[model samples]
Target: MPTRALCWFRRDLRLDDHAPLSQALINHDEIHCVFVFDTTILDALPRQDRRVEFIWHAVAELKETLRQQGSDLIVEHGDPATLIPRLAHRLGAHAVYCAEDYEPAARQRDTRVAETLKQAGIAFHALKDQVIFAKDEILTAAGRPYTVFTPYKNAWLARLHPRDYATWESKTLVSRLARHDDTLVMPSLDQLGFGDTDLCTLRLPLGTSGAETLLKDFLERMDDYAQTRDFPGIKGVSYLSPHLRFGTLSIRRLVKHALEHGGDGASTWLSELIWREFYQQLLWHFPHAATTSFKPEYRDLAFENDTARFEAWREGATGYPIVDAAMRQLKRSGWMHNRLRMIVASFLVKDLLIDWRWGERHFAELLLDFDLAANNGGWQWAASTGCDAQPYFRIFNPVTQSERFDPEGHFIRRYVPELATLDKRAIHAPWKAKVLPAGFTLGRDYPFPIVDHAAQREKALALFGKREG
Candidate 1:
């Protein structure tokens, strides 16, 4: 009797360089590909979610690619824990395979699915694919997970072999993809309970082909990434993050490219990739960090969390041009430049004295490439509550950051156009301008700084200091 397997696609959306998909194709005589819309997750999200739309397009592309081969993708919209077992049983599959997801909730969901699959007598296989190294793969000499990133990154680099980054050849075994006479029609966005979003207007390249387009373009500028990445106005960074989040591009392929093309830029870029794995492993080992401070001592620090102030910050009327611009950019587009992300996050936690979780949740709702590990890690870092966070006293001066990173105010003007007429000097801190633009009244046109940074810095310090004491 011929063996049959079901390859479940989750975060790992692409077919190439896939671990479980390739492994299934090798071990099983026949394979069926699947992607569930996962209503349990979707029902909680806003009706017009960009991530859902992005996934839809990516899934459609994956389906087309699979259709080109002898196989077809089984796209279903429902709870996977209930659906996977039924699908496997109906298809007469002996096993199910999928890429490993490290987020706490996802791990729980996978556990449930695995138990259900086992009850149905279907073997469950979850393979590593999202990161170069994950879950204690890079640990200290004492065999403990590294809390700090530098040592973790060093260990990660030292342990890396060419085999670790080698491409998993799944396409070669495409012949094993099971051909079914049933027509594979994808559900419409409406059918999936998601409305159309501005994803198309954002012009983000979708799916595998899109990832390739961005990778090619980024390679041409990768040499300058280190120097220019901080500037939001420049095209220094690869816009391949969405693809990375969705696994349209393989982590190994990126790591391999960075390793082969050695330079300060590539090394810096590679370190970022390493940081991603570091966060992934951190979350796996310390799941509590997802909801609370990574450092126990910082957990009880008091935050104002003023709802009106938070609304102003969210609407990009914080009266701090740089911070406002960053928030507005996130509001208008589903993404923000990384430098701006840090600046805004610091402003939210330190200047406004709000909970980092508030900003984290907002970003979770908005970011096109929001990964739980990265977003939570970043928020904690900015809030000075994570394992390797910034010192609590070292609050970011939004004006200073803007002048340093976006000197010309090109990024600010792009998003916060109300300040466009202000000269570069005033653009960063328009309220402090010697003379406002003829028609631009400070409070009327743009918000006054919601809180005094100096006073708030002292308050933030006291808040943390009291807790630490």
Candidate 2:
């Protein structure tokens, strides 16, 4: 039998720019690709999860890609620890290779899988393909993780070299793909106890093709990214976060594009990508941040538990136009603009005095691009509970935010269509409009602002004060 290697596909779903796949091809004559629909993870998600559907579709596409290359992906539905080793044993593969996963749960799962493979006398090799820089690659002078982003980013830039962005060229190894005597089968979504979700409604294309489309589109508008990214109303931002989250797009390719041809906009966009890396490292260094505040001093900070208010906020009836619009957008698309994400997060924790974890949990449930590191980083940053967070006193005025970012209320109108008839001036604050639309009333139609922003701001400040005391 030819020496066989198992290429276990994780987040890095695509065939191109894949380090593990390239490495597997380099060292082995026959490469068997596999993807496990991890039940340990899927069991916790809602049946209608868009993320599940997205992954399923991406996997389907990848399997097809492999099939075109005269190979088939072996799809399994079970715990990865059990499934990976079992599959490797059955295939009698010499080694198992995969891309590294950074999330706490993922790290744990990978560890267990590696141990199982080791016990079975199979070498497990994990390559860094997800993020450009990971785990102590960019550190402070004293060899500690940098809590702040700027210095870390600067160091990351300084450490950057031409070869860092070079492609792994997996295409050269396509000939090494294992061909089975009989056709390998892919598990149906229902076999995994998952129902068909209307993910197509979101219009998010799946797999490498989708990533390429979004990247190409973003490159055209890369120059204006900095200028227009702040405005939620404009089509200035790249909708590549979901792609990045799934590793459908390679980070190196993205960084290379931004550096080589991307102008000012690309530079700004690249920094955002670096921020993602910073957060990933943060989570890796401090796994406690998953449950507790990154800044320990803020962990005991009081949060008001107003379920009614939180419900109103979640349902986009908070009466703050920008906040409402953003909430509605999240509900509809399972995605939100980065600027608006900060605004809504701040509104929940600072303005409403709610716990940041509550908002974080909600985002994790709803966001298609939900990665624990970036999600936690963003929420903590907004809540003033993370390293390099905004000061507690720096609460966003939702009305002012609406006026600045959604000046024409285009984003607002798109999500909150009930306020579409209102003029631009009144759009941000429909409750304050003297002459309400023919059949509109604050309490009846839109609902009043759940709590007075000024009152809640003071309450949040005092709560933090008490915690400090």
Candidate 3:
């Protein structure tokens, strides 16, 4: 009897460089590809979510690519824990293969799926494709996971042999993809309970082809990534976050390119890629941080959940130009600059004195590039509540950050156009301008600063001091 396998596509959407997909092609005589809409996640999302739309388009592209190679993707709707088992039993598959997911909920879902498959006498194989190193792969000499980033990065570097970054070369053997016995058509966005958003109008690329377009363009400017990545006005950054989040591109290939480049820019960019892995392992080790503060001591520190102030921050009306611009960028587009992400997050936690979880949840709903681990880790870092977080006293001065990274206010002017007429000097702190520009009323045109930075800093210190001490 010939062995048949089902390749379940989750975060790893592309066919090339996918470890589980590659392994399935070799071990089985026939392969059936699948992607689940996963109503468990989709049912709770807004009707006009960009993430659902992005996944829909990416799955469609993958299906077309598979169709060209003699097979069709089995795109299914509903809960995967129940549906995957039924599909495998119906197809009489010997085993199911998929990429590993580290999130708590995903792990639970995978466990259920595995149990179901096992009960039916079918095997389940999950391969690591998202991260270069994950879950204690880069442990300390004592065999414990490194809590700090420097040591973790150092250990990660020591363990990164050439084989670790080698391409899987999966595409060449995709001829083994099993042809679909039934003619099953993929459903449209409306069928999935999602509506069209600015994703198409924004002209963001979709699937493998889209990732290649971004990678090629980024390589031309890789040398300048160090000096330019901080500025959000121009296209200094490689707009590949969404691609990485959705796994349209291979993490192994990305790391290999950075390793080969051998420059400060590439090394810095490589560190960022490692940081993504670092956060993943962090979540895997300390799942409590997903909801509570990583440092338990910080959890007792009361965080004010100010409703009106958080709304102002969300709407980009906090009266801080840099912070407002970053929020506006996130609201208008489904993305925000990384540097601005830090700045705005600091303003929210330290200046506005709000809970980091609230900000993290808002970003979860809005950011197309949002990964639960990365988003939660970043919010905790900004709020001084996670492992390896910034010192609680070292609050970011939003005005200074704006003046330094976005000098001449190009980024601010682009996103917060109400401050466009203000000169560079006044743009950073428009309220402190010696003279207001004509018709630029402080409260009427733009609201005054929501919270005084100096006062808020003192209040934040006192709050932490009273509880943390």
The parts of candidate 1 lying over 4 Å away from their true place are: none
For candidate 3, give the lDDT.
0.92
Please, what are the lDDT tens digits per residue for candidate 3 over residues 1-469? 7899999999998988889999999899889999999999999999999998988889999999888888999999999999999999998899999999999999999999999999999999989999998887988889888779998999899889999988887676777888876766999999998889999888888889999999999999998999899988778889999999999999999999999987988999998998899899999999988999998788977778799999999999999999999999999989999999999999999988899988999999999999999999899999999999987888999999999998889998998889889999999998999997998999988889999999999988888767567
Q: Is candidate 2 or candidate 3 better by lDDT?
A: 3
Which has the better TM-score: candidate 2, or candidate 3? 3
Where does candidate 3 stray beyond 4 Å? none
TM-score of 3: 0.99
Query: Over the stretch 329-446, how does candidate 2's per-residue lDDT look in tens digits?
Result: 8998899999999999999998888899999999999999999999999999999899888888888989889998999999889988888888899998776778877876667767
For 201-254, candidate 1 gives per-residue lDDT tens digits of 988888889999999999999999999999998788998888999999999999
lDDT of each: 0.92, 0.89, 0.92
Q: For model 1, what is the error of residue 43's alpha carbon versus the real structure, in angstroms, after optimal superposition? A: 0.5
